[model samples]
Target: MSLRDAWDRFTASQAELEADDEQLEARRRGTQPVGRCHARSRATVSGVIRAVTFAPAAAGPALVAELYDGSGSLDLVWLGRLEIPGIEPGRRLVAEGMITSADFGRTHATMFNPEYRLLAPDSAEATP
Candidate 1:
């Protein structure tokens, strides 16, 4: 890539990190950290959406999403859900649910059908 392209990418990443930090702090103001989550205990986190995936299961479709804050990342599984409006990469969200280990040894904190709130896009987070 050209110098201009590389510069743009670098700046973008830094901006993203700052926004992620702010969102995480705001969301976790009175909640547990993702890295410190305890099994079977209720937990909450705020972060930027890293991914959204779709897969099929016996019951039906499943939506698996990952979010990353400054401290850590977590996986959110919505069984029988295909798509949730506003759940996409870079979007900030606050999620609450019981912390549980992955039955299949998968890594990271996880929650099933946790209550979530999509954060409104503010000027700072919306900027490139």
Candidate 2:
């Protein structure tokens, strides 16, 4: 890569990291820490989607997504939804709903059918 190309990549990565950090800070400022969430309690949390999976559920299909802030992570579950247009790994989003204590295998904490908002995209997240 040329010097300019290398510089561009470096700057892009830094921007992504900063944006991720900003999201984490914003989540901490207004919401309860995900790790401290209690069973059946209504919680508001925000973070970046680190992973996503569509699993077979008794009803049909379920979307299992992992949101990770700097402090912690939580699992967001949506039953009967095959896919959401904007939900994917690397997306920053906020979710609000009840935290279920119901056992979900390896899930840390789960929110079913929570209200969510997708944040603005950072180009760094889209870069290969």
Candidate 3:
């Protein structure tokens, strides 16, 4: 699905799902699921990589990417080591994931468990 379509679905479905303070807090702190987020969606966003952070744990590593589209921005977090080639600040990317509110506070939306595809400067289609 197109990015616009996905955003619409997200907004429309958001009101149907509810989460208490504890759940939101855990998701915000990266300790739990943000809410009752759906795993499948056709929506996606193409944006520039504004920031990247790596959170290492005993089990594995988690990568968080801050992406900004023209309308807004969202945090994309991957739970495992992701081989994202050509990933850097200023690089464009198309990501697929579920939108969830920040667990710490109602600051902004985040894309959890993202499976991203990098789009090259000259490539027509996105690549993993």
Candidate 4:
């Protein structure tokens, strides 16, 4: 399948998994790895990219992007070789991973081990 098709399928499957309480609990219990969450949870996010900052000097090419998903907002950071393409304000994305709280004295949480797939209105596949 094409990348776009694969991404779409992945998102759909992920959404279903997230809705499963048993699955969510299993994942939370660490019986299943976070990477298995899939792309649908990320795709289901109703948010827009509020910021994008690069930190290439650190461990990897990291980008701190703020996303407000109506219900709440969270800082999404991509580390290592994960490349966030065309990130900007008003751009919406679907991100899936493990949500962990941060101890920075702020009510902040992180979606670790995330797998994101950008949704474009025109539906063009992201070139690798």
Q: Could you say which candidate leads in lDDT?
A: 2
lDDT of 2 by residue, 59-112 (tens): 689988988776567889888988888889988777899998758664477888
lDDT of 1 by residue, 20-80 (tens): 5655575545656677777788887777788999968767888988977666678888988
lDDT score of model 1?
A: 0.75
Off by over 4 Å in 3: 1-42, 57-60, 104-107
What's the CA error at residue 120 for candidate 4, in Å?
Answer: 1.9
37-116 per-residue lDDT for model 4 (tens digits): 23224322334566766657435566677765433466676666345556677675566665655643325655644676
Backbone clashes under 3 angstroms, per model: 0, 0, 4, 2
* Candidate 3 TM-score, C-alpha based: 0.55
- TM-score each candidate: 0.72, 0.72, 0.55, 0.50
**Candidates arranged by TM-score, highest first:** 1, 2, 3, 4
Q: Sum up the clashes in candidate 4.
A: 2
lDDT of 3 by residue, 15-46 (tens): 23222322332333332232233334334556
Q: Is 3 or 4 the stronger prediction by lDDT?
A: 3
Q: What lDDT score goes with residue 81 in model 2? A: 88
In model 1, residue pairs whose N, Cα or C atoms come closer than 3 Å (at least 3 residues apart or on different chains), thus clashing, are none
Ranking by lDDT: 2, 1, 3, 4
